[model samples]
Target: MRVVIAGGHGKIALLLARSLTSAGDEVAALIRNPEHAADVRAAGAEPILFDVENTATDRLLAVVTGSDAVVFAAGAGQGSGVARKYTVDSGGSVRLAEAAEQVGTQRFLQISTMGAGQPPARGSDKVWAAYIDAKTQAENDLRARNLNWTILRPGRLIDTAGTGLVTLAPPPVGRGDVPRADVAAVLTALLPAAHTFGMTVELVSGSTPISQAIAQLSD
Candidate 1:
């Protein structure tokens, strides 16, 4: 399978790319920084320089065309301010979905956060609130599109090594921490799963193996 990942340089994205490429699948990562090209390439993915925040949809279309799937992993990142939360998180996700629709790439996987659809609590930090709101809009927008979309909302992400085990279920899966590598493992399993279409699931560390967890989704 050929996959296109937005935010290619991200921790999860790089892990996913390496796993996919090692399995003999083709992977192209959309990266904004030219300097990140070597890192993406080292992970065994072809890095396409495209900024999801500043680029046009038509341009994204060219990059997404002919790919088997598109993964929306882009984020505004820490200290980027509130406005960018909407532009990069929500807006970038929608742009990828639009391009995927136009090119007939039916499989679209989005990496979201656990609190996406829920409103922020009273007196929450403005940026945190905006991030959640942006993700909520992204999820809503993807649901409205004519595409096979799966949103994976992982809990507090840690950089620890993956355990290859997780609890995958629709909300409320409750709060917990998950290794970023484990989330990438789950995405690799879900990429070609037709049964996962239209599903919104949450992830965190647990006993079930990654493949078994995904398979159980259909059972």
Candidate 2:
């Protein structure tokens, strides 16, 4: 399968690219920086320089053209302002979904946050709370698209080693943290499942094995 991953420079994105490449699937990553090209290539993916936050629809469509799947994995960095959060997280996600549909890419996956369905609580001072708000909107927008879409809302992402164990369900229950590598494994595992189509499930680490973890969501 040929996969196009947005935000290819991200930590989780790199992990996913490596896993997919090792499995012999064709991988093309859309990276914003020229420096990320080497890193992405080192992971066995062809890096296409394109910023989701700035690229035109035609440019975005070109990147996804003839691809088997489009993965919206882009995001504003932690230190970014709230406005940038909306532009990169929300606007970029929606645009990626739109471009995927326009280019006839059938499979779409969004890497979203765990608390996406809920509103911000009082006294929350993250300043970037808008990031959560934006993610929520982007997920909803993609869900309404014509393509077969699956949104994986993983919890606080840790850089720890991958246990390859995870939990998955509708939402609210799978609201704990998990290793980024584990999330990448689950994403790849979902590639061949028809049941995961049109679903937006939440994910986190649990006692379940990797295969079972993916089965829980795809089922």
Candidate 3:
């Protein structure tokens, strides 16, 4: 499969790229910085430099043209201000979806957050609320697009070893944490699974076996 990943240099994106490429999938990553080109190439994927917040759709469409799928894996860094949350998270996602539609890419895997699609609890940290809202808007945009879209909203991302264990359900109140490696594993597995097509699933890691979790999701 020719897979294009937006924000290919992101932490999780990088992990996903390596996983996909290692599996013999042809991968192209849309990166914002030329400096990261080598990093992406090192992962066995081609890198196209384009700023998600500034790039036009026509150009982006060309980049993804003829690809089998596109993944919205870009993110505004934590140090960025609140405004960038919307610009990079929500706006970038919408733009990528539009471009994919223009180029006839049918499969889209959106890397969203678990808290998205739900209002934050009252008195929640305002900063965190804003971030979640940004992600929610992005998910909503993709959900409305014309394509086979699968929105995977994972819980708090922990950079742990890939245990290959996970849990998937509707928004869970307190059980939201998954290792980056496990998340990448899920993305790679779901790429070809018809069961996940057009599904918006909330995911997290618990004690369940990774293969079992993936099997359940694919079922």
Best by TM-score: 1
CA-lDDT, candidates in order? 0.95, 0.86, 0.85
lDDT of 2 by residue, 1-219 (tens): 999998999988899999999999999999988987999999999999998888778888788889999888899987898888899899988888888888899999999988887887766766547878999999889878898889989888998999977777777764688999988988888777678898877878888897876676645
lDDT of 2 at 130: 89
**Model 1, C-alpha of 145: deviation from truth (Å):** 0.8
RMSD of each: 0.7, 1.3, 1.6
TM-score-better candidate, 1 vs 3: 1
The regions of model 2 sitting more than 4 angstroms off are none
Off by over 4 Å in 1: none
lDDT of 3 by residue, 1-219 (tens): 999999999878889989999989999999988999999998888999899999877788789899999999988877887889889999999988998898899999999987788898789877677788999999888878888988888888899888876787545535567898888888888788777777887778777776666568655
Give the per-residue lDDT digits (tens) of candidate 1, residues 55-155. Answer: 87688888988999999999999989999999999999998999999999999999999999999988999999999999999999999999999999999
Report how far residue 97 has shifted in candidate 2, in Å: 0.6
How high is each candidate's TM-score? 0.98, 0.96, 0.93
Sorted by TM-score (best first), the order is 1, 2, 3
